[model samples]
Target: DSMGDEHVWELLLPLPTTASTSMALSLLTFRLLLTSSSSSSSSEGYWSTDEFLPENRRRLRDRREKLERTLTESGIPYLPSDSGLFVWMDLREFLPPPPSPDESSSASSSAETESRESMERRERSLYLSLLNEHGLLFTPGLSMKNELPGFFRCVYSAASDGEFELGLERIGRCADAMRRSKEET
Candidate 1:
């Protein structure tokens, strides 16, 4: 499997040695493409500004709204995003507390305190907890190797309607359990 990285150029037929024949063939193909039109009513012409139909726009809007509502109800904080379909969820508040000083042998002055590294470690721990215990997969913000900690990227647009709703439901339950567990400690 190419995994969407298919080397398409290699699959193309070798260029003709005679330059004139190649030029004629390219011109003919271009002319045919320009002349052809889609008989399907849903199909849009090349360079059409209105690529998404009204029905498609409504469906996409409904999906995004549902996902946003689900996250809000679940008490998961997320950044405001309008340009893309992905949501950058902020989960810093739900991260587990750092280890107590009494439990550690080595006295790292600032190590015991909350720092970027510590925060990243906690993010990883939370990611693993979600994966193993909740059967939910989350892309750890720490794995991104960026400054943002406890920020997981979630894509709800690609999933089917039923799948997306179920995922949201599971996430809500998982978030509840995680918060409760964190509080008990």
Candidate 2:
């Protein structure tokens, strides 16, 4: 069941515009056939198999390959998959982890109880501020129960290549800003 789900997910993701368009056309044709008074049962055969299925598959495959090549050329870390459109990037190394309670206490002379919470609050604020500033977005980690803080998931789509590049540049700027902010504080 898990394998089937994975297969289905792979198929759904990274669909080329042509495949999507073809599927839409197929649906429309099916609807028309159903409504037409002269619609023959034999005509139903044409709608059964997608006429542009091959072209759609080829286009999607080409797009995936192009994306992979681009990421490789840019030296961006990415997960390679034959079926899926997305190349999941690993950003763990790029992002700094939240300061631990002990680390925060050592860094600040302020009261441990209040300072620890305050520091955490500051870190979360900084992270969100960076995201907002750079136009970068991410889903907070699932393990975060009651706002566990600091964990997040960023999803980069392949649809808008230009937007992705802009977002990455913004992220770089945000990282620099974070470094400067940390140095000042």
Candidate 3:
């Protein structure tokens, strides 16, 4: 509104928030009705949540399993999750080792700070490289306020089976490239 775009403001300012809320509420209500109906045998017209829920659960489980296998094949260690859409994979091994302090620089605090900065930089670089080169994106642990860097959250529930598999392959290839580059150095 402060941008002097009077036409845009005129179009947007008069819209009520209740419209969106009502739409969302009605959709939720519809789903609830269908679910309640499906739970009983008498509702012949309603969609079955029983079938949908189990199938969806199975599909997500399969995806998670496949993702774990891919990460394992890529030699990336991940935290085991009992129930979630994402896996937290540790990439700390890909980070450069912290610098060794000399006798003149015996301060542990400064060394620790430098090590953290280095880890953050390496994680950001790897995140960008994966996105740019392999068309893969992950939630960086830094933004997630993780105490340690190099831990990325990879979601498994957002894509089609083929796309998800392809994404996993891309991640594997990116890991392979990083590993090969490290070996060369």
Model 1: per-residue Cα lDDT over 100-135, one tens digit each: 666444466354365566677788888888778887
Candidate 2 global CA lDDT score: 0.47
Clash tally, candidates in order = 0, 0, 0
Model 3 is weakest, by summed lDDT over 10 consecutive residues, at 11-20
Give the distance in Å from residue 59's predicted Cα in candidate 3 to where it truly belongs: 0.9
In model 2, where do residues sit more than 4 Å from their true spots?
A: 1-50, 101-131, 136-185
Give a tens-digit lDDT track for model 2, residues 136-178: 6654432233243444433443335566557556655655665
Which rank order by TM-score, best down to worst?
Answer: 3, 1, 2
TM-scores of all predicted structures = 0.61, 0.40, 0.68
Per-residue lDDT over 1-185 for candidate 3, one digit per residue giving the tens place of the 0 to 100 score: 12223332222221211222344554565466444554543244323455545655676688889999999999999998776567999987776565555522336635446555666777888788778877987888887778887888887766655778799888788888988988999
> At residue 147, what lDDT does model 3 achieve?
83
Query: How many residue pairs in model 1 have overlapping backbones?
Result: 0
Candidate 2 vs candidate 3, TM-score winner: 3
Cα misplacement distance, residue 135 of candidate 1 (Å):
2.4
> lDDT of candidate 1?
0.60
Candidate No. with top TM-score: 3
